[model samples]
Target chain A: MRTYLDCYPCFLNQALRAARIATDDEAKIKRVLDEVGMMLKEIPLDSTPPESGRLIYRKISEITENIDPYRKIKKESTEKALSLYPYLKSRVVASNDRLLMAIRIAIAGNVIDFGANWGFDWDTEVADTLEKEFALFDYDKFREKLDTAQKIVYLGDNAGECVFDKILIEEMKKPVVYVVRGAPIINDATRADAVQAGIDKVATIVSSGTDAPGTILDTCSTEFKALFHNSDFIISKGQGNYEALSHTSASRLIFFLLKVKCRVLARNIGVEEGGIVIQAGRDR
Target chain B: MRTYLDCYPCFLNQALRAARIATDDEAKIKRVLDEVGMMLKEIPLDSTPPESGRLIYRKISEITENIDPYRKIKKESTEKALSLYPYLKSRVVASNDRLLMAIRIAIAGNVIDFGANWGFDWDTEVADTLEKEFALFDYDKFREKLDTAQKIVYLGDNAGECVFDKILIEEMKKPVVYVVRGAPIINDATRADAVQAGIDKVATIVSSGTDAPGTILDTCSTEFKALFHNSDFIISKGQGNYEALSHTSASRLIFFLLKVKCRVLARNIGVEEGGIVIQAGRDR
Candidate 1:
């Protein structure tokens, strides 16, 4: 979706949050706010939020000299999710509709996001996800697409969320290329993070060739873009990826699995904020 | 309290809100954001939020050519509060402690703030405020000061809130100079607003001689400053006044009556967000 005015303040808030995590130096943090404030003026509202998000995270990294501010947090998140893996698996195995259960678990794990700035309890989120109704469930469409597709490009979101994605991928029982970010931005999963989550064991892991929190096609490598277009079935995860790819004329190949995190995305998807969705991507 | 880093993003958000209220011209609204974004860079952390707030509203006015963007809204708020005035007085009359009930009513009206961006219902807020415990209740201190004080300076806040302040001023039963903003900023009360709220009928309504949302001493006229210094008992209403005067070495004369609306102010005041306070200001 296109950048809204609401996104401007949200961008600055995210910049400050990332900057704080990156460094303790008050001066550097203030510099981040000052520079980011100045930077916001030049940003056009027509561009996708992730297009500007790419610049914001890069700016935070540059000012703080901390390339991966969320490195420690991401590691802890992965470990925490891994510890819950056996239990998560048991739930999926117990469910009559294993694929649907796994999808809910994956969306639940999405609450781990730092960029969304939601203060969520992990246990509560998992329990709530199991019971909470989806705002937009395109399950029949997802099943229909999966039935005909040969290969699936499953885009990964956060580090911990990857473990939940693993359950869904296992249920898919298809040749899946698990797509991660090219580099660290916020808590977005990189190839190393995906591997840490044991995604390598379940599916082939590859970078989307963009370090941005989302897969901005212009920032992606040619090979990754080729794979993205060639794949008949694609799964876009989280608000960032949804934002980056939502405006694309990608037909109906991509199904977005995410919890609506912000007002802009919620309005765009015709869902309330904090509602979960499995939306089918279509031509603009 | 000094301006926190959190205030930067909040300022932008408020700017956007005020801009939208001011005009439908998308270009002008965008201009407000761009200019406010640039302006934020120049603001000093030591300066009060309303010091910068002055410049932000000015920029909006200049960009949109709407000097009093909230003029119509202020009128409606005043009318709404006026409608509630008889009921408010009845509550005060029925109470065993009339002054205390009036104080609660005054604080309840503070929920009328647009700048705080709290989506509050008037009836619910009024009911809640009557029962909500104060985070910092300096009622004993306030009463003691009121017993001896011959003259008072009551710093008024927003338009609808002025009607509530009128009740409190009437309960004071002493000579009161009801201070208001010299010109409009946000929904903050101006001389005209105070008059419309019948503040002149109860107390002598005077302009603080600053158009800023709050009473910044540097921005205040010499007369207002002199009156402020001379008054033995001062009642500062709402967050903006508290924000502006909180840093001053004003002894113990200034009693700040406000609902803690934002995180930064809440943190500074040692209260939780949404708590009410009758805070006694002291020399730093």
Candidate 2:
């Protein structure tokens, strides 16, 4: 992804602010400013935007000086998701068919995400539509299916979404493993963050092995492969996971995410912008 | 400065490597590995030592990520001086002294920073010594025989070493107007560093309205001030300029820069380390 010229000033502003905090001397400040000015003059700004929504999303994350604003928004989004817990719970209880029950469990698992407006939301909306599309879904069957699952892997997204994932895990009434993206990028949930959020108590949190949203089979470790092979269902969150794994032959991998506008995705899914998209492996 | 444990993995290695062009996949590799296992948990058996010395310095300047590293270093250091070309040249040559003829005019305007090291080769041994014992000097000869007829305003240091004022600017051989601390907290340059640097070009670069390095004398414009005032010489740089006149000074101000060990400055200086200084000024 290329950074545009418009963002160059922001970088300068951040750098200057950092310099100010570092020193309070007139000579030091002047020197630093001069160097910065020269740097600005030298580096050519990239005008091109990224090809993938994931790249754009990551760039936005990198460009922000303080993570507080994003954290606050993520918290709000989590609260919204938590508030919908009753609806999610009721939907699970009302589902009758085993497939519908599995889908609901996958959807609930999908709550873990980086938490932003993008194509993943569209996937959730699709999950929501599935309840209306099928008549066999009932709450008891969903509960029964969740209870019997051998293992469940919940992929986490952004910071606040981890909070929501925690809530969802508690409501699952089944043994589940929470998966974090590991070190793919800055500010993503780590084992430390998961522990800080008290997620360690409810589910075993593991690394997905790649920063991209999709499951790149080759990148997976022996432990991850074992877990994937043994799990009854895989719930992947966000566009990154989808991009990496959507074309794979993995049968149980279910992607839930909102759609950000991207030409490739729009063409593939026959949708102009990202929204809820849920594809059972056979559909692809 | 002591780096934190958390900073070691990213800052010492990955981030540092990314600053050089040798490995484009540094961040990507870290990200991929991080996804599979916690970054901290997957410590490498053989970690490579950072490339040090002048070559590392030169290469770092060419890469973008090195900017942050330089900023970090700047934050850790004390005092910085920026010396860009034209402004420094004009200030030195303005006196029209015969000794000024020896200076390399082509490179005369090239920036020469003191203190903080940049990713380039520059001497620091002299600057470091001056930073420590700056207060033990008496300038009775320069002070008693000073001429106010020149209307030169000598710039003073608000913080750190005032050595440059004594050594460099004093060599210009002009009767300098010295400015001292007025309401400020500590010692500021009163023609000290200029004397030390053997500068004879300064008529005066000092405080009239305020002890602040770049304080603007707002009471009179060019018309009223020029009648009473002689040809004004403004030679000031560093933090004082940033604080007092970066925004509002009316006089033609010369600014010198040096990359310092400060995050804020490193970011502003737009370099990975220190040494490089810039000089710029407003044309009156």
Candidate 3:
């Protein structure tokens, strides 16, 4: 989706958050804000928010001289989510509809995101996601695609969310290629984060070759692009990837599984903020 | 009173809000954000937020070419508050501690502020403020100072809030020099707004000379500075005045009557966010 006017303030807020995580020195933090503020002047409104997010994170890293600012947070999130893995798996196993339960569990994990600026109440979020009705539940299409698909491409979002994604990937019962960012950006999963979440055990983890929090096809590695294009069944995860791929009209059926986080994204997707969506295919 | 790191993002948010109020053009709104972002680079940490707030609003005016963006909202707020005046006055009159009730009403009015970024629920806020316990209630000190004080300098806050202040001024039964902004800034009360709220009938309305949201002393008119300095009793209303004057080492007994609005101000005053404070004098 194209960047909205509301995204401008959010961009600065996210920048400030990353800066604080990267450094304790107030001077350095101020410098990061100043640089990022100036950077906003050049950002185009037509580009997806994640495209600009890439630059903001890069600037933060440069100013604070602390690469991978969310590294500690990512590790903590992974460990915490790993502890809940068994419980999550049990819910999926005990459910009448295992696939739907796993999908809910994955969307519930989307709350762990740091970039969304929403508070996380892990227990409540899990319960609520399991009980709450989806804004768009394209379950029949999802089941049909999964039934016929041989190779599934699963797009990974954040670190902790990878464990949740693992549950869904297992439920898919097919050969899956899990995609992660090439490098660190916010708490977005890299190869290491996915490995920590045991995603590597369930599926092959591939880098999208862009350190961006989302999958911008133009910036993706040739191999990952090939895999994305070749697969007829794709499960796009979280706001970032959804933003980058939401409007793409590639010859594939993509299912977006996420908890709507912001007003702009919610408006674009025709969902209420904090609502879940199991959407099928590209939206014009 | 110094600008907190947290205030930087808030500054941009406020600028965007003011910009949206000023114009419907998306490009103009973007320009406002871009300009405000660039302006943050020069804002010093030691300066009061209102000092930078002055610049942000000025930039909005320059870019949008709408000097008084909140004029219509200010008028609407005045009309809304005026309608509540009779009921509010009746509550004060029925209370045994009329002054204290009046003070609560004034603080309740503080919630009408547009700059705080908090949602408004007029009926609920009035009822809650009347019923809630004050975080810092210096009632005895407030009464003691007001008892012997000859002249009072009451720093006016937002436009609609002036009507609430009028009730308190009536209870004061002393000559009140109601201070207002020299020019339009945010929803801050100016001479015209105060008059619209019938403040002219109750108190002597005067301009502070500074168009900043708060009473920034250095930028005030010589007349206002004299009035502020000479008065032994001063009633400073809302977060803006508290932020600007919280640390001022003036030779006067100032009572800060405000509903705690933001985290930074809440920390500075040792009050929790969303709580009421009737604090007397400055803190080191």
Candidate 4:
């Protein structure tokens, strides 16, 4: 779960990417990238990369003077995903294993994220994740846990991915609390993004009350923390949640549905970069 | 020739690769990568990436306290090329165009550099460069020049590559002054490395004075510079020499015989990365 040396350059790259997305101001981008260089030594090698990621993005946002710089991009991303909803739904419904199909669809949608991936091929990713064998699939265990679970807390990742999460939640048919960020942090889905994605139509939408880009439990509100602790099971989506929560509260039956994007996170999950994973609980 | 933003991560990656090759010490590798991170901002975006590259490798040498860390590896690399010499020479002899064949062989040999590349497969590269279409081939112009030229000043790149260069020199049938480094810097061919590769038997051997890992004319000895100036034609090999000399003295009948490697150099040559190039001159 600790950050690797390789993550250092990536930190800068992510900052550069965020700056590019935030504005077309050449001067602003240069200033942000320069700040990233200045802050390199401050990165904690022992902490998770997402923790470092949050810090970098925070600095980027501070310099740009826009807390939600990805605001328009998030809305545009949600609209893009919504455009795919009907086609994706039909694919899941036609599949023999609807749950499995929906899970892959949701994970595939994780690629819609703006904060991590700069851009991704939509059609190829959808077909591959749905049809191809996963690098880490614990579907049997996940199904077993879901069968007995009373309540599910789904930790959402990005704007566009929230729409995919709704499709998966519909498949689960459980009492679900789809968690969104209380404030904007990178491109992580805020309650606004979730609403834009129509996630409220499928489950009770709640804010995590932290804008750390991931569920850093210490930074979350008491209400969300209590709800998280009370939940019988959790479905965590994307690398941000995986990085932040993989080491802490790992024994609490959190199934990580994510694509291994970065080297450090991939190593932590014991999969190759670009590997599709459906891991059953971090402790398991 | 200026460093692109893309080159920053590559610089760190190169430093890490060198650190990994230098010693198995994990801490040393981490230290070197950290040093590279520190040096990132100091890089002049308005200058060539190799200028930044030299600063990075120089730091690695300082931190590891070992100049020419690739010494043993260079020897082994030369031996690997030497083993293929006879087979390659026969291929050249059997070919319809001996000059063009020799040119490809020499360009293929450029991949043997330890400073620019980590490891390259000799057989595949040699086969492909010989069989495939070059991204840039000014062979017609080069042949016209070579028909009248009496002397060639050959700039050598790496140790193992010098062996391949020898095979090309045999095919050229012209008087050649082989230039190697005065001192060790990466796996670049030094006087000792060139001597070991039997370059002395094939051509007149000399050294550029400085160990900057490139043909910086100002840093080169007066004798070598004079020889370079006096030569009727120049056969410049590898990316290092290309970076240093490509812009300044490009019109002085220099035939760049090298593979396009690295993003910056590839961009400089106006070709795709991994391109096999035999450019007539920078301006041409």
Residue B98's lDDT within candidate 2 is: 26
Q: Write the per-residue lDDT of candidate 3 for residues B122-195, one digit (tens) a residue.
A: 89988899999999988998899889988888999999999999999999899889999999999999999999
How do the residues A34-146 of candidate 4 rate in per-residue lDDT, one tens digit apiece?
Answer: 77876776776787766777778888888888778889888988998899999999998899999999999999888876665667787787777777679998999999999
lDDT tens digits, residue span B35-131, model 1: 8888877988888889999999999999999999999999999999999999999999999999999999999999998886556799988889989
Task: Report the first chain's TM-score for all candidates.
Answer: 0.98, 0.51, 0.97, 0.95
Instruction: Please tell me what DockQ candidate 1 reaches.
Output: 0.71
lDDT of 1 at B198: 94
The CA lDDT of each predicted structure is 0.90, 0.40, 0.90, 0.82
Candidate 3 chain B — worst ten consecutive residues by lDDT sum? B244-253
**Candidate 3 chain A, run of 10 with poorest lDDT:** A244-253
lDDT (10s digit) by residue, model 1, range A1-284: 88887888888889888889999998898889889988888889899888899999999999999999999999999999999999999999999999899999899888889996556789988888789999998899999889888989999999999998998999999999999999889999998889999999999998888988898999999999999888889999898899898888873679999988888888888999989999988887
Candidate 3 per-residue lDDT, tens place, A32-95, comes to: 8889889888888899989999989999999899989999999999999999999999999899
Residue A23, candidate 2: alpha-carbon lDDT: 45
Pairs of colliding residues, candidate 3:
none
TM-score of each: 0.97, 0.32, 0.97, 0.91
Q: Any idea what lDDT model 3 has?
A: 0.90
Interface CA RMSD, all predictions: 0.9, 14.4, 0.6, 2.2
> Can you tell me which runs of candidate 1 are displaced by over 4 Å?
none
User: Of the true interface contacts, what fraction does each candidate have?
Assistant: 0.59, 0.00, 0.61, 0.24
Give candidate 4 regions above 4 Å deviation.
A23-31, A63-73, A113-119, A282-284, B113-120, B250-253, B282-284
lDDT of 2 at A256: 43
